[model samples]
Target: MLRLIIKKEIQSALRDTRIQFAGTFLILLMLVSVLVGRQGQKQIQKERAEAQATMYDKWVNQGAKHPHSAAHYGQFAFKPKPVLSFLDLGLDNYTGVSVFLEAHKQNEVLYSAAQEGNGMTRFGELTAALVLQVLLPLLIIFLTFNIFSREREEGTLKLIHGQGISMRKLLMGKVWGTYALVLLIFIPVICLAYFLLDQASAGFDPHVGVKFMGLLASYSLYLLIFVLLSVIISAFSKSSSFSLLSLLGLWIAACIILPKATTNLADKVYPTPSQYEFRKTIAEKVENGIDGHNPSDARLADLKKQVLDEYNVSKTEDLPVNWRGIAMQAGEEYTDQVYDHEFSKVENIFKKQNRVSEWAGFINPYLAIRNLSMAFSGTDFHHHVAFVKAAENYRRAFVKKMNKDMEVNDKPGTEDYRVDKEMWESIESFSYEAPDIGKIISVQWRSVTALVFWLVALFTLASIYAPKISRL
Candidate 1:
């Protein structure tokens, strides 16, 4: 009986031109988004690869110079777009793609894509995730908003109930049948997306497949929540027009209004410092250390005296190691401490701001899915922070290597000491591995919990109230 009802629902939906047109339009939009996204991804990868290679070439080919000088003429760490970014660009547009790593200074990432775009970018891009998260729910609303209301309008509600069919089974059949139609449209689009992804990469990683499947499952559940809600609304509504209007209003609130309002509220609640203030704070903290450029600074003089006393020598020239190199490294280490302290404060503020939205997921599934999509795609703020930490660590190691070489290899009296190209080539190239799927899930537990809660709550609400449809 359930199978018969489900079949009847599908047959009736197939005869409706509205379902046919909406499904076709959705499929075409998804395919177009994938194509445009793949092109953009390829362009980004190409530009970043070329720029990185060019930067490395310049670094390696830079002529012999003082090790400390070479440290100031530092390298760039360009972030590679993740394989899944083609589906969900996420923060990639706002988060800068690279950082300039130099000695005694911790630079912020610069040159975000958003900075180069026109006003249209403010509206957001048409990525596959956007299509699935926002538009797909609209499609679901269209299909199921009148599932029960239309039966009542046509006086078939009495006939169907009198035929020994339970309202629970009837509701279940309609929900599953609507979902089956959605799958017919969705499955092909996902398969096409996979094909595009596979073709874009030289060899796709198996872990990417895992992330893809995770995305598939997440989006499926997200859509199911909407489907169940629409059905429930239709069951309770007096007429098809009321069901449609109520669902559309809910959609506008959940998809459009809530996300923007949440972001604004979060920013107001946990505002971060401006760039000037942040940099000023770091500079103030660093001034307490020895001045590397001014050898005669009081802190440097004190350090010279301390070192000479330790070595039992009258002057720095008479000491075993070059005093200038020691002083430079000490300054570097002190600046590092200051940078770490200041950067931590900023990171904490960012986390606090994000928490506002993470907790908001309970009220809006769109927020939950938006966060989860970005997390899985490796385009979240966490991933950006990870890249930053990696780049800074590499810069510290590179600068330390140069300072160590100056301390050990340069003669004590040789003030103009310089190193060959071999020294430059010795520094390891920077590399970054994105956080694993496990770490992403751990970080996104709030969103995950919200999704689970919505799913269960909606199911329970439907089961309890769906049977009461007969009284209406």
Candidate 2:
């Protein structure tokens, strides 16, 4: 009986010209987004990879120079593109792609894609994730908003009941049929997405397959919420037009208004310090005591005394190994401590800011899916922070190596000291591996919980409304 009802609804929907046109247009739009995203991803990957290789070459071949001078010459740390980036782009456009690593100061990632683009680019970059998250819900609303109300308006609701078909079964069948329409439209896009991803590189990441499947599952739940909500609203409405209007309003609230408002509220609640103040705070804490090599620092005088005592030397020119390098390394270590504290405070503020919307995921499946989608794609805040920290660690290690080389190879009190290009080998080739799926799930646990909450809530609503279909 359920099969018969589903077949009838499917046949009826197939006969509706509106479904055909809407489905076609949505598919075309998604395909276009995928095409544009693919080109952008390929181009971005090629450019960053080439730039990194060139930068490394320059670093190794840079003529023999004083260790400090070579440290100042610096290397660029270019972040590699994630394999799933084509699907979501996410914060990649907003976050910087490269960072400059030098001696005295740590650098923020620089040269974000948004910085290079025009003002209009801030509107949002087009990607398959945007198509599925925002626009696809619009299509689902168009398809399912009137599924029950139109039957009632046409007086077929009672007539179908008159045939002894329970309203609950009928509603379930309609829900399945409407959802099938979405699958029909989305399946081709899914297949095409897989093909494009498979063909994009010579080697495949196993994790990409896992991440892609998770993307499908998350988006399916998101679409299901829209389907169930639309049908529920239709069941409660007197007219199909009213149902459509009501669903549209709900869509705008969940998808548009709430997201923007949450961000604003989060900012107001947890304000971050200004850049100058942040830097000033770090300098105040670490400047005087850390750098024992600085001649004027009375704070370093004690450290200098201890070092000379440990080296068993009474005068400046007597101790073996460059005590200056030892002092510099100690200063670098202290500077790292100061920066780490300051950076955590800043990062915590950012966490609080995003937490506001993450909680709103319970009210808006759109937010839940947005977070999960970016997490899986490795373009979320969590992923960006991981990359940033990894780059910083590499920079610190490279600086320490240079300092040690200075201490061991160069004589004390010699301004003419220099190192061969071979010293560049102390720094390893930089590579980044994104956090695994397990780590991503931990970071986005709230979003995952919200998605699960919607599944239970929407399903419960669907069951409750299924039995109440007679009221319409």
On lDDT, the candidate that comes out on top is 1
TM-score of each: 0.94, 0.95
TM-score of 2: 0.95
lDDT by residue (89-182, candidate 2, tens digit) is 8999889899999887888788887998898779887788888999888988887777788788888887888898876777777777777877
User: What C-alpha lDDT do the candidate models reach, one value each?
Assistant: 0.85, 0.82
lDDT of 1: 0.85
In candidate 1, what are the lDDT values of residues 154-197, reduced to their tens digit? 88888899898889888888888887888877898899988976
User: What is the Å distance of residue 110 in model 2 from its true position?
Assistant: 1.1
